[model samples]
Target: MRYFKGVLASERRIRCIEAEIERQQSRLALNGVEGGEQVSRTMEGDAMERGFVKLYDFCDALDTELIGYVEEREAARRTLDCLDDGDMVEVVYLRYFEGLRFPAILKLLNAGGRNMSERKMYSLHEQALCRLWRVIPREHRQRKSVQ
Candidate 1:
């Protein structure tokens, strides 16, 4: 859950950083020529150099964080896919990946015309979490030994 939430938050942060970078890039391009700030005009090349340094640092951090978030999300998705039950997989996927609330997930899952109560959905979610927890990294070692 933490990893999934982090992925969503990281995506938002990444987008904001990218937007800032784009804004800075275009602004820096016309820094001196256009209606740039008085400070920029006074500093000449120094202000522009500082702007480039700030943009470069932001890009580097954004790249590193984005990569880490993507890798974590992929690992969670793969782990979720390992569940034998399709219902469990769907529940977890909708909750974590899609960021749907319980009511929304219940609506989607119960759309097959079956009368699925909220309590039942909650139970299924708990079951899915339990199943997910069972497939830990140490369990992989056990499976290998058994094999």
Candidate 2:
């Protein structure tokens, strides 16, 4: 469970970093001179270098965290077929892996539920985590084994 949460948090951090890089790239593009090709080339190169650094950091973080997370998650997934519908899995993927917020999830799902607040969303997420826990083998659930 801790591993799952850690994975989710790491993924969210990566997405946030990527979004910042995108915003920076857009700013860099817009700030370039309109007609001077030479000037634009130099600016673009510098911007790309900066963007690369940000992207590299994000990728490194994702790679490091995702390595173990994926292995454990896959192993757990294969153990039990508790997940009947793919929606729960999809929600987990989007919320954790893609770093989407609850409102974004609601919009994406197009499910009408004004009363389905963030608390409910979190509860559902916890349920999913529990399901994953159940799927994982007892030995695998040990702290040292997961690490």
Candidate 3:
């Protein structure tokens, strides 16, 4: 569950960083056009350079976050694929990958002709996680042994 949650968190953080970068660029562009600050040329250059430095920092952070997100998401997907139960796979996929809460998961399941209660969905989620935990260690050992 923590692993799955981390992927979602990373994705959200990346989006926030991207939006901030865009805002900073827009503000810097507007600064050039507005021409109302009435500061010295050197001060203006300093401010602009600082803004770009912040933007570059954000871009670097975003690149790092994106790389981690892709690797984590792929590992999570591979783990999910190891599960034999389609229902369990769907539940995990919707909750983690799709970032849906329990209520939304319930709604989608029911819409797909699954007449399941919230409690049942919760139970299934627990079962899926339990299975995932068991599978992960075994999968890890298998890879290590092969190498």
Best by TM-score: 3
Q: What are the clashing pairs of model 2?
A: none
Flag regions of model 3 displaced more than 4 Å.
Answer: 33-41, 137-147
TM-scores for the candidates:
0.69, 0.39, 0.79
Rate residue 18 of model 2 by lDDT.
66
Better of 2 and 3 by TM-score: 3
Ranked by TM-score from best down, the candidates are: 3, 1, 2
Q: Write the per-residue lDDT of candidate 3 for residues 50-86, one digit (tens) a residue.
A: 8777888999999999998999889878988777888
Q: Could you tell me which residue pairs clash in candidate 1?
A: none
lDDT per residue (tens digit) for residues 1-147 in model 1:
554565578777888989988887887777653334435445666878688778888899889988887887787788887677787788778887888898999999889887878887788777877676665454232222453
Error of 1 at 114 (Å): 5.4
Give the Å shift of residue 6 in candidate 1: 3.4
Model 2 lDDT tens row, 1-147: 554455566556656766765675566457662232343346667765665566567667667666766775565445335766465675676675566887898676656544455666666766776777755556446443564
Whole-model Cα lDDT per candidate?
0.75, 0.60, 0.81
Tell how far residue 136 is off in model 3, in angstroms.
Answer: 3.3
Error of 3 at 123 (Å): 2.8
Candidate 1, backbone clash total = 0
